[model samples]
Target: MSNFLLQLSYLIGSITFIVGLKQLSSPDSARKGNLVAAFGMVLAIIGTILFHEHDGNKIGNIPWILGAMALGTVVGWMMAMKVKMTAMPQMVSFFNGMGGACAAIISIVEFNSHPDGAPGYLLVVFLGLIIGTVSFSGSIIAYGKLDDKIKDISSKALTYFNLLLLLAIFVVLGIAVASPEVFGHDVVWLLLGLSAAYGVLFVMPIGGADMPVVISLLNSFTGMAAAFGGFLYNNPVMLTGGILVGSAGTILTVLMCNAMNRSLLNVIIGSFGGGGASGKGADGEQVVKEISVTDTAILCAYAGKVTIVPGYGLAVAQAQHICHDLEKKLEDKGVEVSFAIHPVAGRMPGHMNVLLAEADVPYPKLVEMEDANPGMSSTDVVIVVGANDVVNPAAENDPSSPIYGMPVLKVWEAKNVIVMKRSMRAGYAGIENELFFHPKTKMLFGDAKDTLGKLVAEIKEL
Candidate 1:
């Protein structure tokens, strides 16, 4: 009867998980999805604890497990409560790395416990090891890049070296798995180190311009690693959940890459850190044009229609609220206000959307590039905030620009352009923006939040 109940509970949990995933498809259902998933996870955990052979046995200490659970609960709560919205991307990356690290550790522990290699377990272990190791290191590198602690590093020669190192490590791992006696555990440790190095090398060459895709790919790897670990342990729930997450994440990653017209190999091999004006101008001479904030405000206030394009810089400045505030003020004055959101605008997928949503911006006002581009030419003003690579006109005009061929917000088509920037420094892709030199563009130099707020005040005075 107890065994039957456990099985039933497990089945219910599985169903709940499925429903939760489906619910998560839309923002309206996301909260319910989270609740359902949490409930399912609870059920799964309870069922596992009750049905496990170690329950009330000499090997299992209930108190120890309970204590560990309590500690984990507190840590999770703190992270949830303390992490800011602006920091969520890096936090997500770190958590994903930790999850992958957990899966990797589990695989290593399980392998060491087996006296004779389980016939099919080696593949599962290898899968976990590779995926977890890669995810962990890649995520860390991503965190560093997103946080601006390390500048973008791109080198093809480095990629080649990483590939060679990975191959050598795998070969050693294969030999050690076949003959554990002669090679000793040192080979396993060496492989682990090399696997970590490979992860770093893998992400290092990829520029910050492609970070959102990298984050998605790393998330997929973490999910796959968890699934592999589940397979090794014959846990149906982990297998199902992991596979679902892995597949979904991979699809999202691919879509993001496609949105940028970047192939998986290109993302991995091409150093995309330099984003600016691509290619030589016809005369091979630099163009420098500047405008004032007062002129920009006048154009915006008098315009029949206007659009605001927000990017990572807006988030970095914690300026979403100010931006929203500015938008509201514009609307009150009868200026049309809308947001042009590029698919890869921020550090992660949907990052810009999430930030805007957090600021309580209306969903209707937020428009994707495809839907917004055609309307740009009719726009009276387009205000770009702390955005660089995404708005670089070179994407359309310069064949040699790193971002060429990738669709952008088309802000250049507007009657007047207002760009809020800190300096003349190029974006992560390290290229100059041709849009800055356009006759219609007015540069507002300051912190995004401060600049937008001041503009709001200045407009009211006008």
Candidate 2:
């Protein structure tokens, strides 16, 4: 009877997971979906602790288990509440790394408990160890890069070295499985060290622009590792949860790669961003143009249609609310206002969407890149707020550019474009924007939040 109840709980939990993931496809039901899934998880945990038994013995260590759960809950809640919008990507990487570490530690404990287990059992243990270790180390590196604490270390020799290191990892895995007695207990530690090294080197040279893809890939690795743990323990709920996370992460990674017009292989080996080669303007020389706050307001207020493009700088300045205010004010003046969002716009996937959603912007008002481009030529004015690479013309015009084949927003096709920035510095890709020098483009120099606030005030007075 006890075993039957436990299985029932797992079945309920698995159903909730699927339902929650489906609801997550749209923003309207996302919060409710998350709560439902969390409730299911809690139910499963309670059922397992109360009813699980092995060989007529109930589980022990209740106090320790409950204490650990309480501590982790407090820490996770506090961190989630305190993180800023700009640091969200780093926070995600940090938390995901923790998950990977937990999975890796589980494999270590299991292997140590049964060092001379069957060959098939050892294979599952070894596979979990390798994947989890790599995910943990790689996620940490990705966190460092997103937080701007680490710089890309790109070199042709490093690329070749990484390939060789990967080869060595597989070779070691084969040997460990073929003859577990060759290195005794020491082989496990050796494999751990190699996996960790490969993970670090793998992410060391990847640039900031490719971070979304890396995050997604590492997340899948963690899921795969967790699934292996589920296999080792024969836990149905654990297996279901792990498979869901792994498959979801993989699908998201593929979508991101398609949006960037780059293959998974190219993303791994290209090292496309961070001090890459630059592309010059169409005419090989730049002509400067500038605009004032009053002019920007006047132009936007009287325009028939206006579109706003946001980027990482907008998140850095915490300007999503003020930008939304500007949008509302313009709409009041009989101007049609909407946002243009690129798939890879900010630090992570769906970043810009989340930022705008936080500001209570309606879902219908946020237009995607492919949909927004067709209307660019008819748009009266385009306001680019803290965006850079997404609007740059080099992607279409320059074959020498590293981001040449990647798709970008066609704001240059609009009637007039206003770019907001503090200076003439390059973007995250470390390259100049050819759009800044275009005839229809004008620079509005200032911080995004302050400038947008001024625009809001100016439009109100008109």
> Which numbered prediction scores highest in TM-score against the true structure?
2
Cα error of candidate 2 at position 355, Å: 0.7
Model 1 ranges with Cα > 4 A deviation = 54-59, 178-182, 274-278, 281-285
TM-score of 1: 0.94
TM-score for candidate 2: 0.96
Please give me the total number of clashing residue pairs in predicted model 1: 9
Error of 2 at 116 (Å): 1.0
Residue-wise C-alpha lDDT for candidate 2, range 120-220, written one tens digit per residue: 89888998999999999999999999988888888888889989998998888887888887879878898899999988989999885688999999998
Per-candidate TM-score against the hidden true structure: 0.94, 0.96
